[model samples]
Target chain A: MDLVVAVLFQLIYVIANLALISLGLAIIFGMMRVINLAHGEFLMLGGYTVVVATNAGVNIWIAMLILAPLVVGIVGVIVERLLIRWLYGRMVDTLLATWGLSLLMVGLVTSIFGASTATTVAPPLGAIRIGSYAASGYELFLILITIVLLIAVWLTLRYTKLGLLARGTMQNAEMASALGVSTSRIYMVTFGLGAAVSGLAGGLLAPMTGVLPTIGATYIAKAFITVISGGSAILAGTTAGSVLLGGLNGIFSFIAGSTFGEIALLLAAIVLLRLMPRGITGRFFRKSL
Target chain B: MNSGILRQMRPTFVYALLGIIFMFAAPQVLQLFTIINLTTAIALAVLALSLALIWGYGGILCFGQVAFFGLGAYAYTISAINFGGSTWAILMAVMITSAFAAALGYFIFFGRVSDVYLGVITLTVTLIFFSLIRRTSGPEYKIGNALLGGFNGVSSPPINLPWNPTSFLFPEQVFYVAMAALILCYVFAGWLVNTKFGRVCQAIRENELRAELLGYDTRLYKLGIFTIGAGIAAIGGVLFCNGVGRITPDVFNLYNAALTIIWVIVGGRGTLIGPIGATFALFYLTSALGGQSVLNNNLVLGIILIFFVLLVPKGVAPTIIDWVNARRKKAPGRVRRRRGSRGEGAQ
Candidate 1:
């Protein structure tokens, strides 16, 4: 019973992690139709923000919760204004340009901080006991935070004015423009919001994974897989995709090992894509956001 | 009609003549190390050409072309160890890689996967290959006589003289072979783009729905071009391993994949000559940067990519072509002929 409980906790954590990493991409790619290949870099920047801040004697909680996202959100705004705004609707060009941006970020980070940085910050809150098994308290916190984050995103999209305008613009930019909405500014804000969300996820994960410029490469693939498998409904699809893929990954990792687990996740995604190329939400939640 | 045919063939004929001359004359002027570097660059140009063929012409922007490249290198290395020869190994590499691509491409194109999903799936496959190969560093992962050296990579057997397996080609000889292959592949690609099949593929790229309405099997054409491109990249991988005398999991890394796309984009897509020139130019530029250690190569490359994508999206070749065409438009007696040729070229 203890083993089952522990495994379940781990599985939920995995799903939450996937959802957190993918939510920003879900908004940017799913909502805006712009494939930001530099997404992983955005996350990396967030992680670095936390690390740099904490190292400079700032509180860890503040760094991760506030500073990271704020800094990365500003960077995201700059990126949008400088690069992304010019290449809207050109999907392939966006992919190429953002890939270049990713490389540039990696290079700049490497040159500034070297290949790796010494992260003194560790996963906070320590360990928690669950019957015969013990789990990281930080992991539990992460799970809770992910749930809160998802709900917050859902609420904002459902109720907020910015969210409403963003959704309207995404659905029909020309129509929204005729109604006197500044679609360009909406795009900029939405992109920055997505970046900010990504930054927050990166900051949150930093303590567990540590910060490396190259770490983005690892996160980018899984995040993309999650978002692509999630289909078009940003929030609901991301949740569904994450649950399915993350559950498979966690269960397989528990049964076999991490390598096979990863392979299994990728294989499952491939099969899922073959069956439903439009993604899980594309087939199931056709009406839901 | 004869004059039209002659005019059409003139550029290719001149290109072939220049390539042959350069192949023989380059070694005389360059040092051995420079020649070897050129050989590697030529191999990469072949890789770029493969991408140009698919993404540029076929309209399939595959992010994982390096999967086939790495597969080819590994296949060649493994097969060479088994056969104790290079000729059969090269053939095996190309065949195995292309077959794998065909299978994967079938699953992708035939499955009606969207463009974004296609990119993700291909990139995932590449990462899987990278991670899978990296894990095979154990002594138990031996294939035939070759040990999958894991992350350490294996020292590839150099290409031997086809008639004499005991005699390996010197770096100079490899340079000659690489140059010759580049020329042959370039000419072959040029000829292909002018063929009926190529036109259909381009038509499908322009409008898949329209092509389907016209009774063309867009999926089949995509798969065909993708497989052919994979085969060409495999050949490039074989040449690359021959140049460096090694094969590693690094070939399948995301950095290399991005670099390949950068080469194609900076060189210009939709044209054969653009990617080739861009590959050579950027290869040398990075090498120079490495030597100088002034500015970071990735940063420079990133900026170049942004600049080209934003301002010079037509790429160097097409831009040059456009400039020349503008110049010719001012000249008398040739304007009408140029317009006629331009219309045909556009199609």
Candidate 2:
């Protein structure tokens, strides 16, 4: 009974982690139709923000929760204005351009931090005992925070004017413009919001996984898989895709070890994609957002 | 007036002639170290050519091209270690890699996976290969005599004379072979792009639905070109192993994959010669940067990519062709002739 509860907790954490990392990408891709390959780098930059701020004697919580997202969000706005603005509607060009941006970010960060940063930040909140098993209390905290973050995003998108306008712009930019909405400003804000969310996730994860310049490479693939599998619906698709894929990953990892676990996740995604080329949301929740 | 076939073949013939001359003359004029470096670049050029064919001409933007390259290298290393010769190993590598690509492409193209998802899927597959191969460090991961050395990589057998298996080719001889292979592949690709199949592939690239409506099987053509590209890239892997004398899981890394795409982009896609030129140029540029230790190679490459995409989207070859055409039009006789032709056409 204890083992079951422990596994269940771990599984939920996995799903939350997937959802957190993929949400920003989902917003950028789902809303904008701009496949920001640099989404991973935005996460990396967030991680670096935490590291830099913490090193400068800021509180860890403030660094991760506030500074990380703020810094990355500003960078995101700048990027949208400069790079992403021109490449709108050109999908393949966006892919190439953002890929170049990803490389540039990795290079710039590597040069500044010298390959890997010396991170002294460890997971806070200590460990929790789960009968025969002990789990990190920080993991539980992350899970809680992920839920809060998701709720916050859901509320913001649901209740806010910005969210409504952004959705309207995403659905039809010309129509939004015709209705006297500044579609460009919405795009810029939406992109920054996505980057800020990614930053927050990265800042939170930095304690768990040490920040390396090239670490974005590992996250980018998984985020892309989640977002792609999730399809066009921002919140529902991301949640559904994350739960399904992350649950499979967690279960497989528990049973077959990490290597097979990864292979299983990839195989599952490929098969899922084969069956539903437009993705899960494209097929099932055709009306859901 | 030039015949249709001859006109189509003219650029390739000229390039081939220059390549042959350079191949024979390079060893004499260049230092041994430079020749060795050029060998690696030549191998990479073949890989770039494969990408140029599939992504540029076929409009299939595969981000996992290194998977086939790495697989070919591994297959060659394992088979050579087992068979005690490279003659059969090279053939096996190409065949196996192409088969693998064919299977993977079947699922992707036939599944009607969108372009963005296709890129994501291919990249994910490449990462999977990287992570999977990186775990084979254990002693039990041996295939016959060759141990899958995991991240440390395995030393590959050099190509030997077909009759006498004992005598391996030296670095200089290997350089010659690499140059010859590059030239042959370039000519072959040039010939391919003019064929009826290539024309259909280009049409599919332009508009898949239109081609489909015309009764052409877009999926089959994509699969065919993808498999061929994989085969060519595998040959590149074999040559790469011969150049470096080793095979490692690093070949399947995201860096190499990105670098391959960079070569095609910088050199200009949709043209065989452009990527080849870009590969050699960027290869030397990175090597120079490595020597200097002043600027980061990735930063330089990133800037170049951005600059090209924003300013020179047509890439080097097409941009040059456009410039040359503009100059010719500005010439006195050419301007009058062109205007006269336009007037005649209007009439």
What are the Cα lDDT values of the candidates? 0.87, 0.86
DockQ of each: 0.63, 0.72
What digit string (tens of lDDT, one per residue) describes model 2 on residues A116-196?
565758876798999999999999998898889878888887889998888788788999999999999999998999999
Give residue A255's lDDT in candidate 1 (0 to 100): 92
Model 1 - which docking category?
Answer: medium
Model 2, TM vs. native: 0.96
Q: Give lDDT for model 2.
A: 0.86
- Candidate 1 on A136-241: residue-level lDDT in tens? 9999999999899889988988899988888899889999999999999999998999999999999999998998988888888899888888898998889999
Off by over 4 Å in 1: B1-9, B338-347
The TM-score each candidate achieves on chain A is 0.98, 0.98
Candidate 1 fnat reads: 0.47
Cα RMSD (angstroms) for every candidate in the order listed: 2.2, 3.2
